[model samples]
Target chain A: MDLTTIVILALTGVLLLLSVIKDRRKTLAALRVAYKGFVRLLPSILAIILVVGLIIGFVPPKWIAQVIGKNSGALGVAIASLLGAVLFIPVIIAFPLARSMLDMGAGIMATAAFITTLTMVGFVFLPLEIKELGKRFAVARNALSFLAAVAIAVVIGVIIR
Target chain B: MNEKADAVANGKKRSMRERIRWDYTILFLLIPAFVALVVVFPDKGATARHVAWEYFKEMAMILPAVFIIMGLVSVWVEREFIVRFLGEGSGVKGVVLSFILGSIPMGPLYVAFPLAAVLLKKGAKVANIIIFLSAWACIKLPAELMEFQFLGWKFTLVRYLATLVVVVALSEVIGRVFFKQGYEVPDEALDGAEG
Candidate 1:
C-alpha cells in the first residue's frame, strides 16, 4: 500500500484498538455503523470510479487540455467551476481525476476552481440545504462559494503558475 | 399516541428504504451502460475499465477505514459536546474549534447538514457553523492527504490555506448579511432531513 493508505490504516487500527479497550460494546456498535455506511455508499463510489475510468479512456487528453489548459484562460476557470458545482463526485475520486487532468495539461487555476466548487457547492443537495439551513443561508452560502471558488482559482493560478 | 409515533417512524423507515432502492437502480443502469460502451469501443472500453480498476483498488484500500473512523466519531462525539464548544458566545475559540472539528475526516458533506442544523438549533454562532460546514466539505484531513498525494505539496498547501481563509471570511459575510438579527433555526424544519 501507498504511504497515505498505510498511515490511514495504521491510524484506524490504533484507534480501533483503543476504542475496543475503552468499551468493547461501543466499538462493536461503531463497526456495525461503519459497515452499514460502507454498504450505503458503495454504489455511488463504484459509479464514480467507472465514470472516471470512462473519462480517461474516452476523452482525449488533448481535448481536455484545450478546454481547461493554460491557454484556456478565464473562460476555462468558469467552466471548471460550473462543472464542479453541478457534479456530485465524492472528494476522494475528485483528487485522482484532477491529477489526471493536470497530467493531461489542464491549467492549475481551472483544476483548483473545479476542486473548490466541487466540494463547497452541491447543486444536487441544494434543496436539502435550503430545507435544513433555510433559503437565505443556503442561497448566500452557495452563491458566495461559487464566487469564492473562482476567485481562489485565479489567485492560486497566479501564485503557483 | 404510541400508534401515531409508530406510524411516523415506519413512514420514515420506508422513505429511507425507497431512497436506497433508487440508488441501487441507478447503479445497475450505469453498469450495463458501461458494458455497452466496452462492446462498442473495445480498446477505449478496456482502457477505461483498467483505469476504473486502479481507482477502485485505491479507494478500497482506505474507504473502509475512513468509514470506520466516521462511525467512531458519530458514536463518540456527543451532540451536546459539539454544542457546548460551538454554541453561542463561543467567539474566536468556537470558530477555531469548529474548523478543527470539521477538518477531521468523518463522512460526506450531506451527512454534515443535519449536524450543522443541530448545532444551529443549539445556538451555535452562524459564522462558526458556516465554517464548520465549509471545512467539513472542502478541507477534511483524508481529502487533503489525497490531494497532496495527487497534486503535490505546494498545490495542496496553497489551496488549503487559501480555502481556509476564504471560507472563514465568507462565513463571516454570510452571517452578517443573512443573520443580522440573530439566526433563528426553525424547530421541526429538519424532521425529514437525512444526516
Candidate 2:
C-alpha cells in the first residue's frame, strides 16, 4: 500500500488495539456503535462513488477539460462552475481532475471556477440538506454558497489568467 | 381544490424565487461558460472511460470505510459532551480549542453534517460549531498543506479563505434559524468530548 494508506491503517489498528485493551466491554460497545454509524453513511457514499465513476466514464475529462481550460473564457468558467456544484469531487479527486483538465487545455478561468464550485456548493446533496435544515435554510445556504463560490472563481480567474 | 393546489404551487414558486435571488450571479456566470464550451473545445464527443474507472475503483473501498467511521462517531458519541467541552460560551479559549479540535481528521462534508447536528442538539454553540465545522470541512490544515505542495500555495490559500467565509456565514445563519430551535447535538462529537 502507499504510505498514506499504510499510515491510516496503522493508525486504525493502534486505535482499535488501545480501545480493546483499555476496556474490552467498551470496545465491543463502540464497535457496535461504529457499525450502526457505518450503515447510516453507506447510501450517500455509494451514490457519490457511483456518480463520480459515471461522470468520469461518460463525460470524458478531455471534454470537461476543454470546456474549463485557459482559453475558453467566461463561458468555460460558467460551465465549470455548474459542474463543480453538481459534482461531489473532493480535494483529493480535485487534484487529478484539475490536472486532467489542464491536460485537456481548459482555460484558467474555467479551472478556477471548477475548483471553486467543487468544494463550496453542493447541488447533489440538496434534498438531504433540506431534510436536515428545513427547506428555507438549505435553499438559502446553498444559494449563498453558490454565489460565493462563483465570486471566488471570478477572483481566481482574474488572478490566474 | 384546484385553487389550493395552485396556492401550494405558488408558495413553492416563491421559495424558489428566494433561492434564485441568492444564486443569480451563477446564472450570469453561466453565460460565458456556455460560449466557451461551444466555441473553444473541438470534438466534444469523445468519452473518458478510463479516468472514470480509475476514480471509481479508488473511491469504492475508501467510501465504505468513511461511512463506517462516520456512523460509529454518530452513534456511540453524545452531543452534550461536545457542547460542554467546546461550546462557544466557553469563550476565546473554547473557540480556539474548538478550531484546533475541529481541524483534526474527519469524513466528507455530507457525512460530517449529521454529526454536527447531533452536536448542535447537545448544546454546542451555534457559532462555534458552525465555525468549527466550516473550517474543519474545508481548511483541513494538514491536508491543505499537501494540496499546496501539489497545486501551488495560491490556489490553496484562496480556497481556504473562501471556504472559511462560507462556513462561518452559513453557521451563523443556520444557528439563528434552525439549530437554536432545540436540535439535538450529535452523538459523536459528544462522545469525543466525553472521551
Candidate 3:
C-alpha cells in the first residue's frame, strides 16, 4: 500500500478501536451508517472510476501535451482549465499527468490551471452537489472556483516564470 | 395535519428511492459500455481496465475508512457542538478550524459535499462551510504532497497559498452576495431548494 493508504488504514484502525472502547453500540451504529453511505455512493463511484479509465485509456499523454504544450500559451491554459473542470481524474493520477504534461512542454500556467480546476470544479458531481447543498450555493461555489482557478493560474505563471 | 405530514414524508421517500434507482440504472448501463470498449479496441480497452483496476483498488481501501470516519463524526459530534464551533459569529476561528478540518486527508470532493451539507444543516456559517468545502476539494494534505512530489516544492507551495487566499476571499464574497444581512434562512430552506 502507498503511504497515504497505510496512514489512512492506521488512523481508521485506531479510531475504530477507540470508538469501540467508548461505546460498542455507538460503534456498531457508526459502522452501519458507514455501510449505508458506502452502498449509496457505490454506483456513482463506479461510474466515475469507469469514466476515468476511459479517459486515460483513450486520451494519450502525448496528445495532451501537444494540445497544451508551451507554444499553446493562453489558449493552452484555457483548454487545460476546461478539461480539468470537466474531467474527474483522481488527484493521485492527475499529479502524474500534470507532471508529464510539464515534461512534454506544457506551460507552467496551463499545468497549474489544470490541477486547480480539476480539483476545485466538479462537472460530473454537480447534480449531487446541487441536491445536497442548495442550487444557489453549488452553482455559486463552482462558478467562483472556476474564476479563482483562472486567477490562480495567471498569478502562478507570473510568479513561477 | 397528521395525514398531510405523512404524505409529505412519503413523497420524500419516493423521490429518494427514484434517485437511487436512477443511479443503479446508470451503473448497469456503464457495465455494458465498458464491455463494448474492451471488445472494440483491445489495446485501449485493456489499458482502461488496468487504470480502472488501480482506481478501484485505491477506492476500496480508502473509501470505507473515510465513510466510517464520516459516520462517526456525524453520530458522535452533536449538532450543537458543530454549531458552537462553526456557526455564525464564530468568525476567524471558525474559518481556520474549517481549513484545518478540511485539509485532513479524506476520500474525494464528492464525499466532502455531503459532510458540508451536514455542517450547513448544523447551522454552520455559509462562508466557513464554503471554505471548508473548497479546502477539502483541493488543498488536501495528501494531494498537496503528491503535487510537491510531481511538480516540485515551489510550484506546490505557491499554488497552495494562492488557492487558500483565493478560496477564502471567494467564499466570503459569495456568502455576502447570496445571503443578505438579517436574512434568517429557515431550517427547511435547503430541502425546499432542491429541484
Candidate 4:
C-alpha cells in the first residue's frame, strides 16, 4: 500500500483500538454511527465514480490541456476556477485529474486554481451549504473562497514555477 | 400552496429519505448507461471503467476508517467542549483547533455541513467555523499526501502553505462583513443537518 493508504489505515486502527479499550459500549455506538455515515457517503462516492468514467471516456485530456496549458494565462485560470466551483469532484479524484492535466501541459496556475476551487468553493453543493450554514454565511464563504483560491493559485504559481 | 412552507412542515427526515431515494435512482440509471458505453466504444469504456474502478477501490479502503474515526470523535467530543473551544473569546487557540479538527480527513465537505451547523448553534464563532470548513475542504492530511504523490512535494507544500494563509484571511474578511456580532443561526438551519 502507498503512504496515504497506510497512514490512514494506521490512524484508524489506533484510534478504534483506543476507543474500544476505553469504552466498549461507546465504541459499538460509534461503529453504528460510522456505518450509517458511510452509507450516506455512498451515493456521492458513486456519483463521483460515474463522473470519473465520463471524464475519462468522453473528454479528451489533450483538449483540457490546451485550454489550461502554460500559455493559457489568466483566462485559463478563471475558466478552471469556474469549472472547479461548478463540479463537486472529491479530492480523492481531483488530485489525479489535476496531475493528468499537468502532465498534458496545463499551467501550474490553472491546476492550482482548479484544485483550490474544486475543494474550497463548490457551487454544486451551494444549495445544501445554504440550507445548513444560512444564506449570508454560505454565499459569502463561497464568494470569498473563489477569491482565496485565485490568490492561493497565484502565490503557488509564483513560488513553485 | 406554499411549497417551501410545506417542505418545512413535512420535516427534514422525509426530505433526507427522498434525497437518498433520488440518488439511488441516478445510480440505477447510470449503471445501464455505463454498460451501454462499454458496448458502444470498447476502448474508451475500458479506460473509463479502469479509472473508476481504481478510485472505487481507493475510496472503499479509506472511507470506512475515516467514518469510524469521525463517529468516535463526534460521539466523544461533547457540544459544550466545542462551544468552549470555539465560542466567543476563543481567540487563536480556536482557529488552530479548528484547523486541526478539520484536517483530520474524516469525510467529504457535505458531511462537514451538519457538524458546522451544530457548531454554529452551539455558539462557535462563525469565522472559526469558516476556517474549520475551509481546512476540511483544502488541506486535510490525506489529501495533501495524495497531492504530494501526484504533484510532487514542491507543489503540494507550496499550495498547502498558500492555502492556509488564504483560508484564514478570507474567513476573517467575510467574518467582519457578515458576522460582526457573531452568527445568529436560524432555527431551520439545523433542521436536517444536526444529529
lDDT of 4 at A140: 84
Ranking by lDDT: 3, 4, 1, 2
TM-score per prediction, in order, is 0.68, 0.63, 0.85, 0.72
Model 1 bad stretches (over 4 Å): A69-74, A84-115, A118-144, A154-161, B98-161, B173-195
Residue B60 lDDT, candidate 2, scale 0-100: 55
lDDT of all predictions, in order shown?
0.76, 0.58, 0.80, 0.78
Scoring model 3 with DockQ, what do you get?
0.56
Off by over 4 Å in 3: A103-105, A127-136, B140-146, B149-153, B179-195
| Cα RMSD for candidates in order | 5.9, 10.2, 3.9, 5.2
Q: What is the interface RMSD of candidate 3, in Å?
A: 4.2
lDDT of 2 at B79: 58
iRMS per model, in Å, is: 6.1, 8.4, 4.2, 4.8
B57-101, model 2: which lDDT tens digit per residue? Answer: 554534444433433444445756665676645666656665675
> Tens digits of per-residue lDDT for model 4 on A79-143?
88987887667687789889888877778999999999989987756755765567888998898
lDDT of each residue in B73-185, candidate 3, tens digit only:
75677877777889888889999999998898766787677567656766788888888988888887767788889999999989988988988898888888886451233
Best by TM-score: 3
lDDT of 2 by residue, A48-157 (tens): 44445445444655566665664567777778889888877657767677867866777666776687667656776665454344455456556656666666666666
After superposition, which runs of candidate 4 have C-alpha atoms over 4 Å from their true positions?
Answer: A86-111, A119-142, A154-161, B1-13, B100-124, B140-161, B176-195
Candidate 2 wrongly placed segments (more than 4 Å): A2-4, A40-44, A69-77, A90-93, A96-110, A125-144, A154-161, B1-81, B90-118, B126-133, B140-151, B185-195
